[model samples]
Target: MSSSNKQAGSLNEKAGISSPEITNASAISQIKNKRRQQPSAEELISGIISGNRTTLSRAITLIESTNQDHTEKANQVIKGCLSEANKSIRIGITGVPGVGKSTFIEAFGKHLTSLGKKVAVLAVDPSSSLSHGSILGDKTRMEELVKDENAFIRPSASGETLGGVARKTRESIILCEAAGFDVIIIETVGVGQSETAVHSMVDFFLLLKISGAGDELQGIKRGIMEMADAIVINKADGDNIKKANLAKIEFNRALHLFPSKKSTWQPKVTTCSAITKDGISDIWETISQYFELTHETGYFDEKRKEQNQFWMIETINEHLKSDFFNNPKILSQLDETKKAVQNNEISPFAAAQILLDKYKKI
Candidate 1:
């Protein structure tokens, strides 16, 4: 074995964990000695742009990794695929639980695919310690749709965040676009107004509602409603058709009461039944119209640019926080600083500055 391989093996054994270096070296050696070929990042990017499922999955994994060293390579892959991205219509869907959000998506996604459009569904489930790393089982709710050749489904856990969305959902959207998906649907857990995280990244915000007697409005939070580009009254078929119509009118009135969006686009309210497949097409048409009007008025590009800026700022802040907290000296001093502040020996502000200064010197 090579020196690096031996060192990697020793580290893995000492740490009682599988070392990534060892795994990577083994992969490289296998490719060279057995497969006789290795795929480059450019090849992966090209394959992703061409809609290869395998490449798309790999690209998403790369972007979602928290490993520091993988970031540069991940960024390179994203940049190479960037020009081929941003073609998809990005949509954010949220609603209270039992409102049929998953069913609606499954139906809507199938509808889009039937129209010969490639669809990517990113379902953001609230993360729990027990289930954080596992793929959400909600895809089973989208069984038939999941089986569609042109549809891609990725269920991401929110990771101790209220939004039940991964921080990388925005980056995942870019990857999906590069993978040639025509429509990218982001589904958030229907837990009150906190779900608005999806709103910032999508072109249209869709709120799914179930018609309940006057209680519909009670379940709807003002913050969430204000961010909605469209309110969908789901489960509109069977015995609830009349009630659904009433609920739609009520929501429309409530929507009108709110000031118009900054983009000058009026939010629309409609009713649909995923079970009976009613009004799904009209919902799709409304989304298309919203995109058309927004694009024509230049808001589409402007909104995307703003989102890009927001992500840049957020990423920088995250990097600074991670770097500061991970520094060995800062970490070692954290307890002492906290105790000093508690004992009134140093003010919190001064303690913070001291730590920051220490970090700067390091």
Candidate 2:
């Protein structure tokens, strides 16, 4: 057979055309080395202070880690960044599903960046009960803002743990502030206990709503209404403008029914279209007014001090719960105890006592 025929017959023969490598071997090796080499706590702190987004994200990952070994290092980094933290305005935004929370955040975030503000968005995506994984698609949703040089968006998974995302979010805010982000926006999962958790951590909590969702007055029944620093009616454009205006009026009326807030600043109701960017600046103005009033009244600092105390207590409670569940003896007997309780062989309280006693013995 001819050489050409032999080449055609050989299925394993190399291609006739030699393809050039698309990637650099040396660069790939350097990236691998960088990934393998973990920066020390001090280095992470320094990087965060110097506004390195990569280091800030790495440090936040350490905080979110469930590995016991990472806890100490995470704490050290947080401690070093403490002073740099708390300088930024922490804003928490939440809403019901389909309320365009991501779109509104993108618009709001872009508006902030336009004013030369360094913005960091911590978006918490709900984790699946079965898979225990988060889609974490906030970056995809906020396409324009994600590309903005002055904006940083980090999406985190809201784990099964009660305080999982909340605790990590609080810590991540500190890192973002240390990274020189003047504005920090925390977008909650919009349901469950997430709103309350986020409310406790933020200086300003804005609830995003849409027109014609339901009876406008119905929202007043929710505890979230009480916690809101402002309620924004999103997607108010084209034909929806009139409905949005009506919703705003209804919400404003509803706001007046609630007793005066401790901060003495009434929660404002406004409308905006994330697509058109209409009324977006007005929302910022409202927030600025809130900060101005709160600062003058000393509520800004006072609320922060109180939140710090609350977190300290929450931390102790969380550690206690973790230690109790993670106890080896309890883990060994947990299934049996749970089975006994489920079968009515033992009372829940008594079974809990048994676990407590076992933990105590250890």
Candidate 3:
């Protein structure tokens, strides 16, 4: 028997089902039978709603898979869970490397858990195959919160994608929500414009900053400040308290120079010391106030709906690109087209059109 057929037979036997006859016809029949036995959308939805973490993780893995065969199943699972999703608060936290973002999140998440809120943290680290980066360090930094039963911490690395926003983070958000998490915190490696991707996906964007450095604001860019719903000046205890306060005032003035974000809301600037755990309550209050104002004005729901639509469109575009490049015919011709352009026999634009057209025909 072929290895593939033997594997299939073993799977069927392990499941206490009768093995099919070992033949090509039986092999095709067994494959169809196995596919039919795969969990349906309803089963996945039920598992998620029941707070089965394993099922939740599997669903997210399916969505994150690059395999074209999984796309349809992933979509069905997401659609099934859509009605049960979106009830959780999505907050994005970002800052420069030394801004102590993970420390603040650990402190902040602990405080929320104290208030009886279930928190899930999705921290996206920079991809480093050979090194243990800060995010792995976060597991150690957030030891208290990580040990809490009510809190979940998932650290993902930024792949080829520009933003540290892991390709799986979006789907993971759904899983977290279905598992009854009240607050979903997304932490990104505060690398300037790339962090904007997180801003687009969340309800509130919080920028963390530290004081006492002459280049304090030098690391912060105007574009990032514009995207901030609020800024938390960290390290506000001890001798740095005064410096932190000064930085707050500086940020407040800078924020005022820009027009108000919405008619009912004004961007806020606050200071806190994560190590000392001071001013954390005030930070939470500010976030609550923003949420209330936006929810009352219907902006919160509108924003979430828009974000979902944007993700759907973005995902489709990514899949289209993958499919085009992975086509054997187009890939086979890619080198020839590049050589033609190099030799000036054809323009780069024309070569691109030819490749695209060939894929379209396929």
Candidate 4:
């Protein structure tokens, strides 16, 4: 032992007091979180399907990787897991900052686990557009849920995506489902396009709002309000109870102004206090009722199929857009086209057509 530690131990011994060893919790946690041993893609697929949480987590990390080989491997893992997907209750939750999303998720996830359900949370944390930095910090907030044996929580950075969701969230959901999670909750990076991106992949979309904020209409846009299957007014306890109820009424009235959805399920509004664990069950009951009604209507399966088709087209569009922009011919002419358009030597449409023709020739 070092002299300082020996002296301290000697003093404790002389005083008949036992000394306890200390641990560096944060350092130990960081060491354990290091990337696991790399295995074959087949191994990863099999491990995930076998319900290995570490392997499942590694598979998600692989999918989130930017490396080309990692991406190819990730695709193989996703392909192997497809048959196991479309079996869970996919719910997307979104609200502005400070709306208690993380707290609600922890409470809600624990509730699900209590009912013998496996819950997976895909939380998107905002990333800096320039430096590509993000804390991916929401996991730290859900200490209890993180320790739950049946729960898996992954915090992803929403880098450069306008929707404020990870680019590979859909693939992550498939991996989670293949790992046998029955409840998949996607928490967005606050409101806006992130909610819509989440809505495209989820079976039900829920918008969380708070009270004493312009009656719950100040921050939320009309389209988002219309897309919400349920609007929850959080912080309903203590002094906020009356305000929460009033906000709930206003939200319900506003939702009534929108046309009915194709699924025939009318949107609803309610209040909840995540801190006190009050009304959490009611919100879940609302989700259960939604699933029951949608399944009975056959809209549930139809929506999933529609989502698949949408993603197929989206993939093609993204691929073609990337290919076109990355073409050397397009790059060579882009500056020329811009100059011509700016100098009035050629119309913008004409310049675009010229570049398109040049790209086609190449």
Candidate 5:
């Protein structure tokens, strides 16, 4: 081979085209800025009150965190925002697993935004029992509402909370209200004890249902029926329309059997289709009528006051339980204590007492 040809084919020879820079200093600087320390309570409060969604999300994340420092900071932010909070209506919606909660919420939330209302949805996604993780896929399900500038959709893991809700959901609502959202919607894991927890936090409790093959009133829980401010039969379109109307009548008749509510507002049964968007506006109108009546009768403010008091006691109980379980001595003995009870070496009550005594001493 010619010497020139050998030189051209050399493996170590520099390429005719040069490669671009591997790192961009400007990009690194931007990333560093993004990774800056958490904001102060005052800064978060200011941003939230000014209607910044990013700041509001960060504040909610802090509230959800279990770290000691984060909890303290979250408390400060909540206190600062408390005055601006409680200015919005909180609505709790729940139903059976296949009751189209995500669909109904999207339709309802979009309707609310169209009427010049800022809506925030706190959806509690069920967590995996084995993995203790959640998909948090509500944002994916509500495609349109999520993209709407005026609508905020936040999905949190149920995380061992009895009511299929995040423990910090109440605090998140306060932040959302302070951020100037006119409407706050809480979607629970399903219809169970979670409904009662959600019911206490919300101004109105809505039970979503769909027509089934069996009797409409058969599987309904009496406590849940009594707690409902409104029973909405969703998916009232196509061939299901007639069945939905029949279910509505059955629910209405059942509701009338309950004692009169303190608010003096009769719980109404209505039907709607989330997919076709039919009867969606009417549902809102019914909700509006509820607000008008409750506000005029002073039941709205009174209910909130009662809820606040109830939550105070609940907060104490939660902290006490957390402290009991988290104590160093209790943590060391809990598993062994459980095993002892399981093996019949000790009564469950006795085992629990032993742990409680140890906790008290600690």
Candidate 6:
């Protein structure tokens, strides 16, 4: 051993202080054998722009993390990505349960990749308030697309966001676009008000349907259909083919009844078989035509701008509500006010005004 090391060890022993168990040689080896340091935010953005899949995945994970440290880092990564200025066709696909949404997405995503488009699928899964977790079953459902090198699939929980989409989905899309994906598909939890939320964000909204059911019309809200750019009927093979065609005709008639969208493009209805892969191209053609017409009319860009504005306002309102209710002073006051209203001491609005006044004071 070196003289200095021997002297240090001797002094430590004399003083009853234990020396570190690691020898200099072991320390050196440890340094040499250490895992590579993690890349910085800029490095991650660079890697993502270069189409590095692992880095892309890491960036997405960072974005999804709820921790404060992760949030700051995720913001940095997302900010760096925004400079790439990648614009993609954002599509929202929604259907009631059993409408083959997953199968259709798998097939549609593969089709986009085949056409030299980098496709990213963001799936919103139902959340359980009791567990605070989601099924996260999109990966399992889209096995084929999961293996495709050109496709990226991220399944996220709805997480108390009544909109049927994960809160960070818009941010996730920004990351994927920066990673160079040209086609982004958002699949909602189901066909409800969630459809309205998805419709607000996407360029083309497609509603998937199935045929030969007693309550086929009951499952799909007419308001949801009005928002759709196209309604696609899945499982259009085997004995279901004739029934699927009949349903398509019925939906076409139903769609004609609604006022035309601002885009001025008539929503098309078609049948597809995610299992058999029938009528896949037709759906693409319909989407392509919608984009072409909307872009030509300038409504496409206008809609996106409106959506951004809406989101900005929505986010601000959400934060205000969250902050007011979560304020330390407000929480206790709210608790008292709730009992007051329950006991007929105050009207509901009066109780709410009390909390708002308290929030303002705080």
- Expressed as tens digits, the lDDT of each residue in 1-362 for candidate 1 is 44454443333455334456535866655655655443567887888888898888877877778888778878888889889888989999988778888899999999999999999999887766785675588788999998999999998777765557786888889889989899999998777644666878999999888886457778768888888889999998888999999998988889889997878889999999999998999999999899888989999999999988988997898789878988889999999999999999999999999999999899
C-alpha lDDT (0 to 100) for residue 36 of candidate 1: 43
- Tell me the deviation in Å of residue 284 in model 4: 0.9
lDDT of 1 at 66: 80
Please give, for residues 60-113, the per-residue lDDT of candidate 4 as tens digits.
989988665676788899999989887899999999999999999999899999
**Per-model C-alpha lDDT, please?**
0.85, 0.88, 0.83, 0.87, 0.90, 0.85
What tens digits encode model 2's per-residue C-alpha lDDT throughout 1-362? 34453332122246463223674656655766776799999999999999998888889999999887898999999999999888999999988889999999999999999899999999998888899888999999999999999999999998885533545888999899989999999998887578888988899999999998878777534688989999999999999999999998888888899899999999999999999999999999999999999999999999999999999998899889888888787898999999999999999999989888888889
TM-score of each: 0.84, 0.91, 0.83, 0.85, 0.92, 0.85
Q: How well is each residue in 188-216 modelled by candidate 5, as lDDT tens digits?
A: 99947799899999999999999975778
Off by over 4 Å in 1: 1-39, 129-135, 192-194, 335-354
Ranking by TM-score: 5, 2, 6, 4, 1, 3
For residues 1-362, what per-residue lDDT tens digits would candidate 3 score against the true structure?
45454544434555334455564666667777976776776788889888876677667767777788988888888777777788899999998888899889999999999999999998887876456343456677788999988898877767656656787688889878887899999998787656778987899999999987676667688889888999999989999999999989888988889877862578899999999999999988999999999989999988887888998898798878888888899889999999999999999999999898888888
Query: Model 6 off-target regions past 4 Å?
Result: 1-40, 68-70, 332-334, 338-345
Looking at candidate 3, what is the lDDT of residue 311? Answer: 87
TM-score winner, 2 or 3: 2
Clashes of each: 0, 0, 0, 0, 1, 0
Give me the overall lDDT of model 4. 0.87
lDDT for 88 in candidate 2 is 96
CA lDDT of 362 in candidate 5?
A: 73
TM-score, candidate number 3: 0.83
Indicate whether candidate 1 or candidate 4 has the larger lDDT.
4
